[model samples]
Target: FIMENCDELMPDYLNFIKGVVDSEDLPLNISRETLQQSKILKVIRKNLIKKCMELFSEIAEDKDNFKKFYEQFGKNIKLGIHEDSTNRKKLAEFLRYHTSTSGDETSSLSGLRLPHEGEPDRPFYYITGESREAVANSAFVERVKKRGFEVVYMVDPIDEYCVQQLKEFDGKKLVSVTREGLELPESEEEKKKFEEDKVKFEKLCKVMKDILDKKVQKVSVSNRLVSSPCCIVTSEYGWSANMERIMKAQAFRDSSTMGYMASKKNLEINPDHSIMKALRERVENDQDDKTARDLVVLLFETALLTSGFSLEEPGSHANRIYRMIKLGLDIDEADAVEESTSEPVAVPKVEGAEEDASRMEEVD
Candidate 1:
């Protein structure tokens, strides 16, 4: 009954699990470290991982128990998905997320699409944020949710890294809703309608693009906008706002590289939105309309916040908000702040004569 400590056979993620094995295929007196070199032990390790995956599947059958297990040990699963290459697919099955439809409840990656037979084969659409509540209310999911598709809300700190590694599951590509090119499988009629809208809104989008030339790579009529007027989205290869924050927080990240990557963002405008229609009218009336340009700047800044990107020019953002407040209140723009003066105070008739020494010093 010699004790064996073969912890090295297991991944650090599974260190919480304890197990013992007795085999007569190898000598009993062999040290555990030396036995690790044995091909038999390597085979045993492979089998152990397989068994562990099977055990997880069984545990998942009982949803309540698995929820408890996941809440307690879920970080380990995420770490495993990120660090374990050979077993990523198996570990991905254990991934869970809050969703647009699941109201505080969580669903697995496979459950992130419409549950109908005749549904179009959609990719696994998801949004990452600082937390579940933040993503639940994001502008990115508006059209997807309106189209009856569920979106995975990836809120954990490590969820992005884990999903980046997983990439896909069950043959469906995991795509971020915040990515610029979201090609929904539209019917022919829908495509024609979108084409018409694109033509109608082309000039307006161009105006917005020119207004935000330095801040955004492009501005176009959006397929993803249902209720929101606009949103900022990253390019296919660019860092998302969440990923940017993570990398920026790293002590060793290159600022120039990050700046270049972060610059690749686009704005998507809702053709049907009232503000958009009014702005288009304003633009048509005058291409250099100061009010229209100001409104575009405000819209872009607001979209930055709603789309999870921090404002690079917060001072300008604040000033723009103040201007909006003034407009809403119909205050005169010519009203400037009064200047403070350091003119000498005229002590009126010396009520107590306390300033006599200061007045004498000034006279001197």
Candidate 2:
């Protein structure tokens, strides 16, 4: 045996690959000093890693066995994506992900490779969350999915870390669908239409921004929504909702950095949604309309959840929902808190009880 453990050579996750590594090139009586600093051992280590990668490739060809192998070591590959810089590209090719279009199946990066003939354009879209259900049900995918495009769903806790190192693959940058300024290539007509809507909703956007001034960075027309009214999205490189949740779950996370890490999110409203149309009319009529302001705040809160963020002001959100219910039921808005109609219970012979206690003490 060359050595018992090769954690320094092999990835920590691949420590399970145990076997007799007999090298004729390595001396039989190789001392600890030689083991610590041997060029031959480094070469052998490199060859072993290459062979393992080749083994992974071979196993990948067989879907059934690969599933079992991957179940045991898939996280290792994800970890390697961040930890192994030498073979990151090769490791990325082995990556299997459940995309919006893959249904229950997973696709490799090679399978979804987009054309990279353009001038460094066309980014690969991805979404990160706590589970498949959470990732797939996000409002961020509405328009992207509507356009017959697919987004990789990253549900694992370590996925965010893996993806940070996998910034780009084969010239295409990996981008999250839940970030601001995500503009897909569009036709001139579509671009013109978007600009026209932006012009039309200028006043509404201003009013919404003013209402959500403290809660959001800005309110603008959405480029990623087809059916949803609004959604909260982080800045281009801001921490994702999943990442934020993971950080908060950590016992030793720095609270000061959390605020910095959360960064600032911007609210986006779909210009074509019916709610937006009505809200625009209300804003045009009166920017300070109480109903319009309430609706705006409520939409922002709901968008916070739809985009996988916890509400910072749940109490206010609840109150707004209650107000909506009251409005729906035609309840009077000015109703005051009801006073207790039952009279306060009279003190039941408390004075006599004190006098009796005093008489007993005197007798004693």
Residues 93-183, model 2: lDDT tens digits = 8888999888888888768745344534677889999899987888888888777667999998989899989999887788889888887
TM-score of each: 0.85, 0.87
Top-scoring candidate (TM-score): 2
- Ten-residue stretch with the least lDDT total in model 2: 28-37
Tell me the alpha-carbon RMSD of every candidate. Answer: 4.4, 3.7
Which residue pairs clash in candidate 2? Answer: none
Relative to the unseen true structure, what is the C-alpha lDDT of residue 13 in candidate 2, on a scale of 0 to 100?
52
